[model samples]
Target: MNLKRTFGAILTILGIVGVIWGAYAFLAGGDSVGGVSMNQFSSVVPFIVGLIFFFTGISLIKGTKDTA
Candidate 1:
């Protein structure tokens, strides 16, 4: 398989999970593994990561083929 495709797949999955977990933490109010309390801004980290992965995945999946 293509390297880009592989990385893209991983990022996509991470993004989805991050967004979901972040939302859950935000709503349910929980502490992270390091004991960090979830809050309005703190809980957004996952969502941010998710967005990064989602966008990166899209970019990778739609990237132009190299002819070199």
Candidate 2:
């Protein structure tokens, strides 16, 4: 198995999951837990990180060579 390709796929999946979770959280409006406001940090951080991970994984996968 190709390590790079496998890892890239994993990363891509994780990123997609993260992005979805972030969007859900944002839409759900659950930023506050105990009188403390996250100021959208809870959602924005994951969304941004997700985007980064997604693009990085995509690039890595595209850059890697697939050899049988």
Candidate 3:
């Protein structure tokens, strides 16, 4: 079992999910809390983090590949 590849796969999936959810939230608008909306923060942060996670995951997976 390749731990690096497995972990990378997991991260990649999570990143994809995060990016989708974040985009949805950003477009759909977020609910107000105490009359203060966190729409921008919630959406932007997740989208950025998701991108980071995705790139990191890809790097890990590629890094673990056996080269002939």
Q: For candidate 1, write residues 7-56 as lDDT tens digits.
A: 88788888888888788778766655336568666788888989899889
Better of 1 and 2 by lDDT: 2
TM-score of 3: 0.78
lDDT of 2 by residue, 11-50 (tens): 8998998787777667767665345354455778878888
Highest TM-score: which candidate?
Answer: 2
Candidate ordering by TM-score (highest first):
2, 3, 1
What's the residue-level lDDT of 8 in candidate 2?
Answer: 90
lDDT of 3 by residue, 6-41 (tens): 899999988897787677767767765345465866
- Which run of 10 residues does model 1 get worst, by summed lDDT? 28-37
> How large is the C-alpha RMSD of every model relative to the true structure?
3.2, 3.4, 4.2
Candidate 1 segments exceeding 4 Å error? 30-36, 64-68
Q: Where does model 2 exceed 4 Å of error?
A: 31-39
State candidate 2's TM-score. Answer: 0.80
